[model samples]
Target chain A: MSNGASGAEAHSRTTAVALSDVNITFRLADSGSYTAVEGASLEVADGEFVAIVGPTGCGKSTLLNVTAGLFPPSQGRVDIFGANLAGLNRQSGYLFQSEALFPWKTALENVAIGLETAGTPQSEARARAQDWLTRVGLGHFGPRYPHMLSGGQRKRVGLAQVLIRDPKILLMDEPFGPLDAQTRQIMGNLLLDLWSADRKAVMFVTHDLEEAIALSDRVVIMSAGPAARIIGDWRVPLTRPRDTAEVKLDPEFHRLHRDIWQTLKAEVMKGYEQTGGG
Target chain B: MTRGRLLSLQFLIAVITLLAWHLATTVPIGGVTLLPPFFFSNPVDVAARIFKWFAEGTIWKHLWVTLIEAMLAFVIGSVAGVLIGFWFAQQPRVAAVFDPYVKAINALPRVVLAPIFTLWFGLGIWSKVALGVTLVFFIVFFNVYQGVKEVSPTVLANARMLGMNDRQLMRHVYWPSALSWMFSSLHTSVGFAVVGAVVGEYLGSAAGLGYIIQQAEGVFDVAGVFAGMFVLAAFVIAIDWLVTLTENRLLVWRPVAAETRTQA
Candidate 1:
């Protein structure tokens, strides 16, 4: 109840993102209601980096989408920046797991969209987008289309695209999920570097425990679904300026990994048995 | 294929086809025409008739009339289709309500409406334009509807999260998506627009390439009919070439398939 109740109480103080008793259910015509998340609550403090790790199909993304205001909870509440979120969450930016970029836009145009939407003149937006692309190491790729870039490069563009808006909260759903292992590490380090410069409330959803531990201030785990809820929360005590590849070697990292895995393994096994190893 | 080799192959094909056509029409078999020269004019006769039409500049007026009708139909139909498609796509309830009626209208043979259009707009260019509009509208409308429906939900969510208001979302997300689909269907719709115009003219018209062909057939002038067809084809090919050029320029963002053939 502390996990479910903390978000609502935290609202009395300043909190970046607070989801209180959020429940999401999909109405199927033939079948009855399919509950994805029930009584799930979480809170992210200002400038904190939090990662939610869980078994596959554990409704981790549904929680993030609720915070983004893309899907309203059937019951419960979502408060962002100390205010109730009505429709779209303007204070947050989302990086999707799939190819969310507009394939028709060049890298620069894609990055510049938020500024333009905010009524910045086209030229200023373009210049600022180019600067952000440079920061993401894609300055020269400004004119290139999404299809022309490699998967890693596109993720870099997606990073630049979301980060350019300067959203107070960043909701990333497995942003580097499509990358190779080596690229994922590089991106994780890059994300850490950018985040260290100016911290924001980041809710990163990933199933990779090592990635979650390497890049987060706190790690939250949700149970396997049919109405998934938060099962565990742990503070990551890893040092700053961390390299995702190098951080795994620490004994403390291994200890945290083992402890979290102990809780996570049971859910993973249950999920497998229920789906018949699907 | 190398450009030179491809061009040579194309030239060879045209020459062989023309030779076959010439021999079939002119050469008699068993003292009987294999294909009557009066009905199937020899390539040489058709070519001569085409050269004569160009020399006298008599085909220009008919070509102009047909071009105007097709262009008008293409412009008007595409604009209306896009506007309606966007409106219907954004309003799912309205779209569902009108879905069956739209399908019914689209399923109706547009050629059947040509006579009715002629009755309404007379035998002028408007009747032909109306017919062509009908042909172009449904292709664009259906493609646009599908484009809007098939829009990547992830991308839409991303756009919304990026703080795009309704107008910006439509302009940045929906418009570009629908435009891509519409552009992909342009080749088909453009061809159909010409078909509509010519068919309308053929059914009954005082002017246009179709009218010339119809008049030539009435007087048993096979060469004239073939000449008119050749001119019509050349005109359509030119328009198609322009459409392709515009498509390349606008859709530069689209991914091209890797060149499967080994590099030279």
Candidate 2:
């Protein structure tokens, strides 16, 4: 027992997240079973931002879900902060691909919910939530419910909602997938600015290649499914404080984009063939 | 439509209906009554009956009884329904076991149970309240169950990820989701509550507006019957208006039809 404890402590010092030989199979009572991810091993170091990019049906989100400890992999195990995760991860925050803010709560209340659930006094939670709303450029919109805000504004509230929790690891699944190009660019830059100040282990999942390259220290690509696995990994050597839009104009960015696309394009075509161009 | 236009149209419809009723009942055709006053009382006589009831203040006793019965039924039934609904939603195995029995009970004609309720609780306020509860319970129960069943998966996941325990999740998520559904059917459930009370009274009772109307029918006092009906209609409308106000205040986060029009 003491040996296990020492091993876990040592693992915690070096790794923020570790998934060893994870396999996820979804059961369909009528059609048998479908494997989403198979024999996938990965790790995120403390304070490292790793982006997983793949084809449309490549099971990227499934990988992120495993990291979040929402559900255990059908085979193998997940470790969070070096402890074997048996249930919901207590040390991570997730930003969903779609709107996940409580529609019944106003922006301030939504932001404060994490604290409120953790036993913070209502008044103190509200005060801190208000501060986060201001940080996200929604100071005046605190009293407005999610429905009253435009899409971009609601996304800002969602960001504040997760960020206010100060989770040791952040799992984002296409957090800006629904926005228009202009808003997406703005949100990307804002995220980078916020993240740079207090670096945490981040595992971002998206199909957007430019987004993955612009925002990550390492970009990992997964193969198309029937049992998808990590197919490629690239080190994003872009300098610090790089702008998402401006960085695209860089010659190095173009070269990396081309190299990554060479691998990604084939997987995308295979996925399309499997789905009959859905 | 504009509020002013809508109000004028409503007033016009009411005025035309009343004018037609008065003419049909009072006007003579070929020196003979078009419709006998005994069967269809004149508008003036109905109005007079209403005024007389108000002046005597006797109407208050019956009105108060009915109101109390309906309010009690609404509160008790809503609480039970919401609690049971949550339990069943949380325990699907229990729900599956009892599903057929519940359906059978719900499908049974509620009015037929009035005599049974009277036998169980005696022919007084409790019997009427029991009937009202049966009517109120099903609507609220089904709505609460449906609300919980249809709670957004993403929201549920988000709540769990926020480190909310079971009790916290219930208070913050399930309760609010159920409430929105309850308020959506507020008017209908409350309306059923009143119907259950009045019907139970009309079938067998010594007091209440329903009893008054039943009494008027026995003597062929058409004006008194019409007066009782008008009073009942007004009472329901007033109560429903109050329900609407409460719903508006509680569900301020929800978008209303009027707000939607302006938004677009």
> lDDT of each structure?
0.89, 0.89
lDDT (Cα, tens digit) per residue for candidate 1, span A1-278: 12323233333446899899999999999889889999988888887888999888888998899898887999999999789999878899899999999998899999999899998999999999999999999989999889889999999999999999998899999999989999999999999888878888899999999899888878899888878889998887767767888889998899889999999999888777766785
lDDT of 2 by residue, A139-233 (tens): 99999988899999998998899999999999999999999999999999989888888878889999999999888777889999979999887
> How far in Å is the alpha carbon of A213 misplaced in model 2?
1.0
User: What's the lDDT for residue B151 in model 1?
Assistant: 91
Interface RMSD of 2: 0.8
lDDT of model 1 at position A156:
94
DockQ scores of the candidates: 0.79, 0.65
TM-score of predicted chain B versus true chain B for each candidate: 0.95, 0.95
Candidate 1: deviation at residue A68, Å?
1.0
Best by DockQ: 1
User: A63, model 2: CA deviation in Å?
Assistant: 1.4
Write the residue-wise lDDT of candidate 2 on B1-264 in tens digits.
988899999999999999988887888878887778889998899999999999999999999999999999999889989998888989999999999988999998899999998899887898999999999999999999988888898899999999899998898888899989988999999999999899989888878988899999999999999999999999999999889778777887887822644543
Clashes of each: 0, 0
